[model samples]
Target: MARRGQYAKGAAKRAEILAVALDVVAELGTRKASNREIAARVGLTQPGLMHYFSTREELFLEVLRARDERDHERFHSPQRGFQSFLDVIAHNASVPGLVRLYVEYSAEATLEGHPARAFFEERFVWVRALMTEAVRHDQAVELMGPDVDIPYVVDLVIAAADGLQVQWLLDPSIDMADRLARLWQGVRETSWPAVAT
Candidate 1:
């Protein structure tokens, strides 16, 4: 095993490469992104780059994981509900390339033996659990009625978020954040009776 210092250095180098690779991929679509190009930007030869990532797909998946980590840290908070999710959707609007990469890989990972399959699977499971918790939180706070079906509401929220990304990708004019907020208002109004004076 490598010494602690060596391991830390290796990890730092990996992060550097990932950062450069993300930018390179953002500039040139993923389809056109080459390992050699990434290596050149990061001051490494193609073979040196391969030492860090055994395959192109491996490197791409690492980028996806890196992006997810960044997003989680940036948007995640104790608050969990429709409005919190709206902020996330609005944040996503600023990173179009990363959004495209995620959407594409998620669809491709559905195929057997894909490298990103496990990542996408775990992501979906985690998101569902988070959404369920959010719904429960809303109920506890009376923001959402306890009588509402939590599972169904969670499913709808996840489905709407994922579907909105696809639609927004196809048409930049789509206001995903606003649409979701409106949906939330509708859900709230229909799920709970209005307070009477």
Candidate 2:
């Protein structure tokens, strides 16, 4: 149908815009990247860009969404598992903008009735379930303690990862990937003392 074709083209255009915006953010950093600059770099007029994303906030939020989709593809593809999550987190640290933009956008989304609120609220639930499932499986398979506090431990790890992201964004010297790997090692080592060493 013509309508379906139009929607597909629109989605592809939006994806192109996001890819260009990511490069702009990577070069200019999130604080200095502007919608006008992104549009110019992407060979679109500001209004043309607005056709895909009505507002600058919406555009950047959608950029964040694109980043999430990229993560899913690269990290949680057809054969996803616990190691994939760890690998993704480690890989995510290499792109400071990705994590920083996500956190910044999430903070804005916390405001009531914000355009990005649903996006982030749903993202939270998705991430929580993912962590719960991954941790539960690891525990069940004897990778972690069967008696461990599943929800509490998973929450702590997620909090630590997010917290480290904030800190790393504030100061890249923190070595986010190293800290993340160390946290994983710590948990695994603690739970499975025999094989850790």
lDDT values for all models: 0.81, 0.77
Best lDDT among the predictions, by candidate number: 1
Clashing pairs in 1: none
Q: Which lDDT tens digits does candidate 1 get at residues 1-197?
A: 56998999888999999988887766675876888789998899999999899988888889888876776777776476556667778987877776788889888999998878999999888888877766677778887786777677777877888889999989989999999888776776677766788
Tell me how far candidate 1 lies from the true structure as C-alpha RMSD in angstroms: 2.7
lDDT of 2: 0.77
Residue-wise lDDT of candidate 2 within 1-197, one digit each (tens)?
99999999888888888998876765676877887898888788888988888877877787787777887787873234367677777877677676778788888888999988999889878887887777667776777776666677677777888898888777877876677667766776676535444
